[model samples]
Target: MNHSSLDSTMMLTSFGSFRPLNYFFFSLTLLVYLLSIFSNVFLMLIIYFESSLHKPMYIFLFNLALNGLIGSSTVWPAIMENLLSDTQKMSFLACLVQIYWGYFYLSSAYTTLSVMAYDRYVSICKPLQYHSIMTPGKVKTLLTAANIVPLFSIAILVYLTSRLVLCKYTIQNLFCDLVTILNLSCVKSLLVNLCGACMLASLVVFPCTIVLLSYALILTVSLKASKGAQKKALSTCSPHLITFINFGVAILFFAVYNRYSSFLPAEVYILITIDVFMIPPLLNPIIYGIQTQEIRKCFVKTVRKNEIFFRICELTVFRKSTSEHNS
Candidate 1:
């Protein structure tokens, strides 16, 4: 491979034969992408204007929304082009960039999720010390660590994977995922697969375990507290816990199922991916804002104001048309 094709691993293997429903799946992917973008942006706005949302939980949430936006941008743009075009070709550098960015975005989000777990852990495990431990300055440090750790990890993974060059490029997934891309290597891949597996276990699997354990302890502690305090704790944690489930289950799909089996079809791959990338961003705002009375009222008022402005604009354009008549 030349310097230009630095790490080309596009091996063309039919995962079997294509089906007509591939188009159907791709169309659904298109819809999911559009909705993901719209919903994430709305969530971002709700956080932006709401002074009451300045807590660390909401800060982590804003980070997730931003990361989800970046992740969708990396996957969805190529996907849309591939679906519409006859030639579905991505350049070597371009593919590498996608792999890099996808890793970066996901790592940042995963780190944030882990930090969130510890935040809850402290709140429940050490209630009075929670304020001292989960301070804003500390939260910033956690966010920074979450973002930086992933960058270093991705740099190493990319460097390692680049050692193998493909005879030609063939990938089964809709976009350039690391798993599908790694399997594209023509060279022997046992060691690479092992290393990647370790990385997934460390990054994805371990963090999820932390979250699960944290929440378990949190629930246990809350149960020991007074009934009112227990109810309030449950209310606060429930939305985060549910969003975490949506995200965690999706990560599990990528970490476990996608690694073990190549037996599933492309549509199944797409759906699994959408579970992680598309659904959480769409669901988070609805989960949090709908349950929070103040946010729900603000959203309704915003909608009414927009509707009124739109009707006034239409009336202005359609007004008696005195100028047109004179002309």
Candidate 2:
């Protein structure tokens, strides 16, 4: 391809594989995107309004839901747009924007989960000091760090990526990805790869280590505690654990697919791509909403309140109609 031809746009070649089932894929993707938005937004709203849930753990959960929403919104719009359209092209600037947000979401997500792990560690292992250790000010600081660090790091990566001279314009995956973008570069830079490695180390690997160590300590404490305490600890950590494992799987697929996509069949490649975007945002809310007792109770309460309001409206309507008839 001519360099001038790709000066403004990048093609997503994988989209061509699904053209035969474009309508079906579009409808399915739209449904998942809507559900992800609704679930994440609903969770955030519940945490926001329920003053009783104004605590450290729930606040982190709120951030997680917020991240999920961000992640879904970052890619799902482009995905749905391309799904319906014949051309699967994105401008270079828009691709960079997607790459920035997509990676930011991943970074902030792991960072938030690591913070949540530390919160749990304090709550379970150092119960008495939990309040002091995770003060409201500290919570704000952590949330700020979780979001800001990722934003800065991803900005650097995207900046480096933007500076590279690109000889290719086709991205193999569904959305703009840093790894795919790096692969598009005509010349290889060791500095970019080094920075990427370090970023992954600090943002992804280091946070993952924190999560593991925190849980290991939690497990040690749980093992020595009473059975009731063990059950409580399990209940508290299970949702985060499940979400982490699910996310880990998605990232693994992402790495393998990007690195070894040539060995994989087209169907498998498409499935992996869709799975990366779809599973986590869809599952995170469900996992936390169902597994976290406080959120579950709040949801029930909110539903009951709505039901009561609807019943009151029905009764008022009936009374108004009866009075009008009698008159």
Candidate 3:
């Protein structure tokens, strides 16, 4: 696995010498990555262990957690290595793979979110047929679509990207991402840009609108009911909404900043970090861990259980390092 280091991380712009505070940001980001790994793993395990959470919403949560785990794992390690290294020179192939996975989970998250919207739609709009419409077969079909639909998009974007000659591999952003990379190409990346714009629309715009519209209808239906009924309905879905916000806000921020910014100095760099790369992993687990009670309980229980197991292991250790030290 070719890992990219940070020494090659330079933009084509004039901000050639202003080294953004690397130690602080690097340490902070590493801590965030560790937290993401810890929390997301716990969440996935909890969803697996707790049968009650195997329903529509929590299942979506599980899928989201898993998607985040893989996506962040692919990108952030390389990012951290670059930040700390003297020279962050990522190989061509590694860069391509990174871009691929970035697009993959992004699209997957969109598809899953849209499916969740439809789940809500059926559950609310046609309450009588909710079970029938979102049945095992139907859910499986939806799952298949989620998996397959984005691959076609990725194939097109990546193909266009491969044709472009990379004149400057010095990426402006912290990580070698699609936006930063496309900016470095010699040819007009307008087609690739269009591809990105279209994918963003399909993945983010469409699903978010559906989620909003479905919830609007749901709210309308529930508002016509007793106070108790409305509260209960809202309570059931609040976690999913938070998840949507976590992913959606970052997506929105990136969509706005990337299109508008003319690759300005620190302005563009900071925006890319916050919106595209840094925030989503940090937010995913927190939103899920806080909002989903079952996940929270299971996570606490698992932590306690693991602590006990670690204590036992520490007592039984072969003490290989200590043995070497003593010798």
Candidate 4:
């Protein structure tokens, strides 16, 4: 806990009380991580390999799945490792990396959802112009913007945080985040706080505004159209709406928890922290997979195709064995 050595290593004190349940936590975390990886990867591959799913809508869903995978991979493994380790110590450099990607994961998520809202808006509100507006090149541009903006923006925050003089070497949470690291600073920089507030507005408020506007337009258009059109719009936007609400709630709770951690119980704090990373990644694929007809159909077809292939292999093996015995 030497202040001088804070530059080399920092301890995660959150794991101290839960040391006795390390095995249980490790098992549960591993399960969730595995499930998250499998679901996201499966959804991504389905969208990628299926030629029919190459439209703007499916493409956006694919990116969302990819984002979930990246976000989950960024933190879950570290949590799993720390749970099982005797020393819940992370190196200074590593903590910064986690904070960087952690912010990237969250910001990119909102931005991607914003982009998706725009896609749905174009598709439902301007069906004739959907393809023209969301051209492959444009899609690439939007995706690039979704990722790069968050990356550079977060890099600045992390850089500012890196220059701070720390009064403490221990973080109270399971994984590193900007707020936790900033709390440990010996003296808070006004500029850093300003940048963080601006970041919150840019990363959260701006994207949310875009989502609202896009959906509002879609809603207006849907109301004026035929029942069939209304149904189509509802089906298309429902999954995205559900996803946005789920993520929005998690972010809202996270913001509140970080600001008011002093007033919250330890168990509430832990649950909020874990839920931020856990629920979205774990449920996104499920929501889309279950709600989208094309995805469900493709998944069933895939399972049947694999089953048939395996059955054919077994039959061939049986025939070969029978011929060899007779000979």
How does each model score on TM-score? 0.82, 0.95, 0.80, 0.95
Return whichever of 1 and 2 wins on lDDT: 2
Provide the overall lDDT of each model, using Cα atoms, as 2-decimal numbers: 0.73, 0.88, 0.71, 0.87
Q: Clashes in each model (backbone N, CA, C under 3 Å)?
A: 5, 0, 4, 0
Predictions ranked by TM-score, top down? Answer: 4, 2, 1, 3
Candidate ranking (lDDT, best to worst): 2, 4, 1, 3
Worst 10 residues of 1 by lDDT: 7-16
Q: Is candidate 1 or candidate 3 better by TM-score?
A: 1
**lDDT for predicted candidate 4 compared with the true structure:** 0.87
| Residue 51, candidate 2: alpha-carbon lDDT | 98
Q: For residues 1-327, what per-residue lDDT tens digits would candidate 3 score against the true structure?
A: 113322233432322343567667678878988888887887787888878777776776777778878767876787666666656666666666777888887788878877777787677667798776777777778777776778788878876776667667666555546776677767777888898889878866777788888888888888788888777667657767776777777676666666665645556666655555556666777876886677778778878999999988886675866787899
TM-score of 1: 0.82
Better of 1 and 3 by lDDT: 1
Q: List residue ranges in candidate 2 displaced over 4 A.
A: 1-7, 17-20
Instruction: Give a tens-digit lDDT track for model 2, residues 132-199.
Output: 89999999999999999999998998887778788788887778887777788888978889989999
- TM-score-wise, the better of 1 and 2 is 2
Summarize candidate 1's per-residue lDDT along 1-327 as a digit string, tens digits. Answer: 246357443432322345566588678778878788887888788778878877777788778788878888887777666665555666666777888888777767667777787886787678799888888899998888777777787877777766666665776666666776566667767777787777677777777778888888887888789988887777777777887777777777876656665666666776776776677666776787766555677678778988999999888877758668877
